[model samples]
Target: MKTLLEAHNLSKLYGNGRSQVVALKDVSISLFPGECLALMGPSGSGKSTLLSILGLIIRPTSGCVLVQGKPVEEDERSRARLRNEFFGYIHQEFAVIENETVEKNVMIPLQYARIKPSRQERQSRILQLLKQLNLDWAVHKNVSFLSGGERQRVAIARAIINHPSVILADEPTAALDRKSAEEIMGFVLSMRDQGCSVLIATHDERIAKTCDRVLHLVDGRLL
Candidate 1:
């Protein structure tokens, strides 16, 4: 029951003076390994903003973030290394390179990590992930040619290529139909079972029911 990630008094503010807005207000959350947490709320509820902070895509205005019980430093060099080594993020947008082939898109993270797998090994891993997400048939297709769901699956593959300790997902199933959404939720559940903590920012009621815990966020704080 060790914690995988923790946020203490985390907050984010945008703009300044009269136009300043508080995106997150001293929100705190702790996630343990093997747990799937659904961060649920209506629009402008700060779910995505919270996810971005958790994934290290953005820094909190104040407070501390810890991964695996270790405090994170504010140094840019350290943050970048930690993000590359310990976390996976599936953003709301597919974020895949439209000009690249699906395989290449998925392999981009691995290459960035300087993981020199054999061509066969890389292809095998990509195929396995594609199969898991029901997108193996699009393995060789150009990213631009695939539908949104397919692109999202590719993005998921890319995020998970490193087998990260934590996965942060923002509206991961927004582009999928009901059946596909369920399939994706099941995949996330399996990740939790494997001891990789999963944090999802989603408004999908159906998907929320699949998580071990549902945190309701209102305005900028957990409700």
Candidate 2:
């Protein structure tokens, strides 16, 4: 199978000279279609940095990211396009708008879609996904009123609403209880089973065990 995403000799540096910190060092990784890969490491071990680069959320100080075997240009427009069209990102912090309704937050992605959906179609799709994630009841509730698990569910619904080719999750289960974590993983893995490549940065052994492959990182380098 063709690789869905590839990172070659990637490195990210912050600051300069004596004040500089190395976030990622010469790390290379790949995600293939229909596969689930786990990135396990301690905090500040570069898992988030790698995910950011792969998802085009940030540019690598060095090296390149390829999609379907072609190197992506480092232009803002191109990056934004790829991020919206090809990548689904589930952030550890639950990157949802606290003031917005659950339905509105999930519909944000659809607005930027390459071929924008009709207002009616967008509503139907959001409703269907929220129902699947068991969040239909909170469709009109403000995000700030929801609990951590509910917020995470809203994040998941937003991430996959665009039907991205790759899902990049950074410690998605970190803030959830065991039951909620399992539910979250189930939703993510279901996407993988349906042919979306998945890369999750996690500290949970149980979560790592469920992936098709696992990679370890320490001090910015892959082990």
Candidate 3:
């Protein structure tokens, strides 16, 4: 399989000297197209920090990330472009703009990716994505009016709008009921089956078991 994302001997440090916190120490991971990988650990085990680095949102203090064998430098402009083009993130909080309409939120990625779509084209695709998640009815509503499940669906649609090669989800199902969690996982698994590499940072064993592989994060090292 082709590697979609790779972290080479990565480590992240915060602060300086004696007060510095080592978030990730010599951690390396890779995600390939069409596979799902899960990272399981308790709080502060460096799962989210690792995902941030792989997504190119946060730079690693040491080591490098490569996309298709090219090293990702600490170029803000370039990294932002790579993030829009290559990775999709689903935060634990489902970070949607509360004041924005669902459709507007979904279109954010298209803008970031510099994809110029005709108004109709953009509307059509966003509607289609919302419809897929049974969210078409909520398309015009502000995200603040939606329930937890609805918000997550909107987040999912937006994350996938660019058809990203890799997706990093942090505790994707932690806030949902079992059925809702399963429903969300169903969509994520479908994405994997359709060739999107997925990396999930979660503490739920049941969720981890659904993936192609599950690795534990203990003291910043994969177990």
Candidate 4:
């Protein structure tokens, strides 16, 4: 498969002198088309840091990111555009606005989408994704009123709304029961099959094993 994204010699650090903290150290990884790559490690093992850098949410203290064989500039404007155009994230906390209705929450990305759709088009697309994620009936419900599983599905719906080429998922199934988790993963794998690359940060061995390959992280280093 062709390389979709790559992080080379990544190192993220916080603080300075004796108070310094290392979130990642010389880490390098890649995502390829039509694959789900698992990134597994204990809490605070730099999993999220790595994913955030790859998602273009933040820059590595030292390293570079490449997309489609070309370097991605670190300037906020360029990175922001790339994120809106190419990346979708399923955050562990289900990052939807708690006070917002499902319809409003899912439409957030469209505001920044490179190919902005009309309000009518956004509604149509949101409804289609909501239906696929079993969220159609809850379109008017505020996120805070929904259960964890439902909220997670809403997060997934929001993630894919822009039709991103790379899905950056942070503990995607941590909020669901077996059945719901299965359904969520099935949808993710379906995305991979459709030529999207899925990079999932998870601790569940069962979930990790389901991916095409798994990379283990320990104490800010890839193991």
Candidate 5:
């Protein structure tokens, strides 16, 4: 399989000198389409830090991220564009706008991509995604009215609205019960089967077992 994302000797640090904190130290990994990799580690073990770098949310202090085998530098404008175009994120918090309708939220990524999709097209996609994620009732409802799991699903729909090549999930199952977690995991796996490479940062044993591969991080390094 062709690699879709690669981290080369990546490292990150906060502050400087005695006050510095080494968040990630020389961590590297690669992911390809049709694969789901689970990232496991204790808190402050650099799992989230590495995910943030891979997702283009934060720039590493050293090393490079290559998307499709090409190095991606810390160019704010282009990096932001790459993130918006090729990467989808399912944050632990399920970052949904409380005031926005589910349809509007899902449409945000497409709008950011400047596709100028017609209302019909947007609605069609939103409805299809909602049904796929079993969130149809949320289509026209305000996000704040939904439960946590529902909100997560809605956020997921929005992340995938643009059909991004890669999905980065941060503790996706952290807040859900067993059944709901399994359902969400099933949806995530479905995306992998559909050719979206997935990288999930999690400590959930069930999630780790469900992954095609597991990348373990310890003390800022891949173990």
Candidate 6:
């Protein structure tokens, strides 16, 4: 099968000279449709950096990212368009707008969506997704008022609202209890089973074991 996303000889660096930090080095990987891949590494080992590059949130200092075999341009507008069209990135920090209502947070992606939906249609989709995630009751509530698990679920709902082809999750379960983590993974696995390419950056062995394949990183290099 064709690869959904590919990172070729990717590397990222921050700062200069004595203050330089290597976030990733000569790392290359691929994600295939309908597959779940886990990226395991210690903190600051570049997993999040790799995910950010792949998701088009940041550009690698060297190397390139490709989607469906075509190199992605580094232009901000182009990158933004690609991210909205093909990727759903779940940040480690939940990245939800704390002051925004759950419905509004999930509606953010749709605002930039290629084919903008009617207001009624957008609300309908949001309501349906919140219900599926068992978060319908909190639809109008501010995200700051929800529990960690609920916040995470809101993040998940927001991420998948665009029906992205690739899902990049950075430390998705890091802050959740075991049961809540499992619940989050259940949703991720469900997406993979339905043909989304899922890449998760995690320290949890059990979560890594559930993926179809696993890659380890150390000191910014793939091992």
- Return the lDDT, model 4, position 46: 94
lDDT of 5 by residue, 1-223 (tens): 6799998999999998999999999988999877899999999999889989998998899989999999986669898888888999998888889999988888898787756688898889889889999899879999999988898899899899888999999998898888878888889878976789999999988788988999899889998
- Ten-residue segment with the worst summed lDDT in candidate 2? 186-195
Backbone clash pairs for candidate 5 read none
lDDT accuracy of residue 44 in candidate 4: 95
lDDT of 1 by residue, 87-201 (tens): 9898787789999899899887667564577879888988998888888898888999987777777888888887888999999888787776777667767887666889999
- RMSD values for the candidates in order, in angstroms, are 1.6, 0.8, 1.1, 1.1, 1.1, 0.8
Candidate 3 lDDT, tens digit per residue, 1-223? 6577888889989999999999999988888778899999999999999999998888888899999778886769889988887888998789999999999999998876676788788899999988889999999999999988789988999999888888899998888888889999899888976678899999998888889999899978787
TM-score per model over all chains: 0.93, 0.98, 0.97, 0.96, 0.96, 0.98
Q: For each candidate, what is the lDDT?
A: 0.86, 0.94, 0.89, 0.90, 0.89, 0.93
lDDT tens per residue, model 6, 64-107: 99899999986789899989879989877899999999999999
Stretches of model 2 off by over 4 angstroms after superposition: none
Cα displacement (angstroms), candidate 5, residue 18, comes to 1.7
Q: State residue 182's C-alpha deviation in candidate 6, in Å.
A: 0.8
lDDT string for model 4 (130-218, tens) is 99888899999999999888898899888888889999999988878888888888888789867789999999998887899999999
Off by over 4 Å in 1: 114-120
What TM-score does model 2 achieve against the real structure? 0.98
After superposition, candidate 4 runs with Cα above 4 Å error: none
Cα lDDT tens digits for candidate 2, 1-223: 7898999999999999999999999999999999999999999999999999999998889999999999998679888989998999999989999999999999999999889999999999999999999999999999999999899999999999999999999999998889888999998999976779999999899999999999999999999
Can you list the residue pairs that collide in candidate 3? none
Q: Which stretches of candidate 6 lie over 4 Å from their true place?
A: none
Lowest lDDT sum, 10 consecutive residues, model 6, at: 187-196
**For each candidate, how many residue pairs have backbone atoms clashing (under 3 Å)?**
0, 0, 0, 0, 0, 0
User: In terms of lDDT, which candidate is stronger, 2 or 3?
Assistant: 2
lDDT-best of 4 and 6: 6
Give the C-alpha lDDT of model 6. Answer: 0.93
